[model samples]
Target: MFSSHSKLYRHASPGVQEELLALTSRLRSVITAQGVVRRTTAAIERSQWLAPAEWSALQLEAMRALALHAGRRVPYYREMFARLGIDPRRWRSLDDLTEIPVLTKDEVIAAGERLLAEGGPWLRFKGSTSGTTGRAMAGWRDRASIAFEQAFVERQARWAGYRRGERRAWLRGDPVVPSRQADGTLWRMNRAENMLMLSSYHLTPQNGAGYIEALEKFDPVMIQAYPSSVGYLARWLEEHDRNYRGKSLRGIVTSSETLGEAERRIIARRFGCPVFDWYGAFERVAAIGTCEHGHYHVMEDYGRVEFETNGDGTANLIATGFGNRVMPFLRYRADDRVVLADPGFACPCGRSFRVVERVLGRVDDAIRTPDGRHVVMLDWIFSGLFGLVEAQVVQERLDEVCIRIVAGPEFGHREEQALLLRARDRLGAQVIVRIERVAQIARTRNGKFRQIVSRLSGSNETDV
Candidate 1:
């Protein structure tokens, strides 16, 4: 959901908000599962078993179709192809993509409507990405693309052994409860999907016991959560000498952030289940997920991934997506990094996808509030904002956080107030926030941007 809809939901009473949230999820399930989703998912499941060469042949065909469509229709790629003297008809292998320049996020922002197809690209819709950088980029998606993406998510769950209608818990960044909510009620049940939509923002060391108690009552078979959000609870369980008492829990699936090995061990130990880490981008240009064997495998059939190797053994991802023709990205450079497996390494699962040794970057520390809230996936606070170029949050004390921002020309007190209100919603109103305007926010030593940072010492993890 976009931030605009979040603002509207914020206006409703908490009781009405829960109903609205469930209604929205129900409606989306109907639309996304309509026609093409099931068929596509079955086809992908079959393709995963094909030989390596056969998989490559399938990807080459999809790349040909998407590239041809872009060249003949989209104004941006049409002009680019014309200037470069390239013929879409003769596009043969994955190597042909190198002829066109690798597109960057800045280029996509500047190109605007030129990136949009002229006509007949069919069923286009707008989408925005507020990733770990805290920068929002607007793009488009088609109906067919949305279905394909949903199929990919379902496939990952299948890999984790989640059957249809199985009870699960969602511990993501969605504000399921109001900020001022007391009484230790942090979750609302979605009977339609058999899901417990838990508020990730309200998780703190103080009232966190209630979360585990509620989960034991629900006894969900699967728990899908963010690494940071669930890690807090996992550590709390260990420190308190309490194991996760959900008798039906079979496994844990984590996504939207990097999973540290230490956190993975603790989570697996506390919950008595394997942790499956999933990696994907908002651009739909790349994907990586763990199999039943706990091995990371890049979903080669989902997208074509090329890598630029760094001196430190990590490789930057360069991708071309098969889905989302409304916003087809050819040779788009996603700054995310990963390490690849050694040659001849293959999974015992018998899938043809490439093995990934490790996924790097995308690690944001949880913003711990004085009230015990461990705030994760802070990209929501930066979504759908205007006149903000870049922003970063730094926590140096238990009760204070500094928000450094590169303000645009239209940024003023109104924008600043909105930000302050958003922070209060997650971190609690009592936490002090000092907004600082700067020309730029410094990147990491690897030229990576981190939006949510924590500087509190001895507060990283528990000693259970």
Candidate 2:
């Protein structure tokens, strides 16, 4: 298909595209059920493989090395260490870090300007995270950190049956650049026919149809995306046809949000693919990924995890990446909730990473009612309410929770009433529950949709 006189078209020949497509088809075939199961099982086996005494020693050594590195190179750490009158050389274990005091988001923000002014190390590249609260936080990382992050992701993919150089479509919130401007002609990432980049934000009814069309053309081996975006496309595909599985995708890898059972079933059924919900965050750098066995295994060798307790007895998860250098975060509170996996539980596969039952919710989501007499868990309210494709709980007034729901076609008066009954039972008789059918729910400026939102800025006076 290459024209003799044309230069760009030479690289875009039909034979080249066909060759890429054939290669991708082979890659997708490797993503088998047996592979996913082995990977999932391997996580537990790997963890169990670690001798307790050996693991503890390694963790302590890592912690000591990190503390010394931070104390010497990072200005903030140097100042903080001096303020605390601590000697970096004297610190030997992870427990010594507790004496350093916790660094809040405000402190990080204040120090950020100075950090940027310092221009960072030459080897480091700029990376920004929409921190736990969807607030912007900037940091720097070296090439090693980037490699480690890639390794963790690739390792998980391998476990899930994906091999290198496979063609997979990435559906992300961020749109790929060098996009087509003049016409409908789509540009593949690096002119690779097998890999297609689709925007998650533009997933409207019309755009979703277009997305399906693109998927048919790309014939990717796997579909990797956020659960919400995938759900939107999956539902659209199912509604459009009885058997709407895309031509290329054999499996789906979902991340960045809680994948409800209702969500998993819908996407799996609609796409005729297994949906594996991997858990990770920007703060922690893809720390954990779930296997087909539905167990979440931490990439333990990559990072150390710690559980902190609030006065209320709730557990908060903290992670420290041993890989990052430019801005090493040791025992950084990830602001996620998790419960430990059973100690003796072993998976048949042999890679060693600790497992987590599930990630409950974010730290800020649990709210204190107006009277201060009750605290409500957002997940409790959402427990069995996944029938609604999209939902948000808005606390604009005390004793009143405005529930905005985007209902599916199956949603009816009876479903609505059942939801109301559940809410009333949870919120109490005095609380007023308002239900509304809205075209769209308002997202935070950072483009994060909170399942539960509160306007109260630590103000409780509005409660009656």
Predicted structure with the largest lDDT when compared to the true one: 1
- Candidate lDDT scores, in order, read 0.81, 0.60
Worst 10 residues of 2 by lDDT: 174-183
Looking at model 1, residue 91 earns an lDDT score of 66
Put down candidate 2 lDDT per residue, 33-74, tens digits, no spaces.
Answer: 344334544543355458555565666777778777777777
Error of 1 at 222 (Å): 1.2
Model 1: CA > 4 A from native: 1-15, 120-124, 459-464
Q: Write the per-residue lDDT of candidate 1 for residues 177-208, one digit (tens) a residue.
A: 77777556788877668899888877777767
Candidate 2 Cα outliers beyond 4 Å, as residue runs: 1-53, 85-97, 113-121, 132-134, 177-189, 192-194, 244-250, 309-314, 339-344, 361-464
lDDT (Cα, 0-100) at 1 in candidate 1: 49
For residue 414, model 2's alpha carbon misses the true position, in angstroms, by 50
Worst 10-residue stretch by lDDT in candidate 1? 455-464
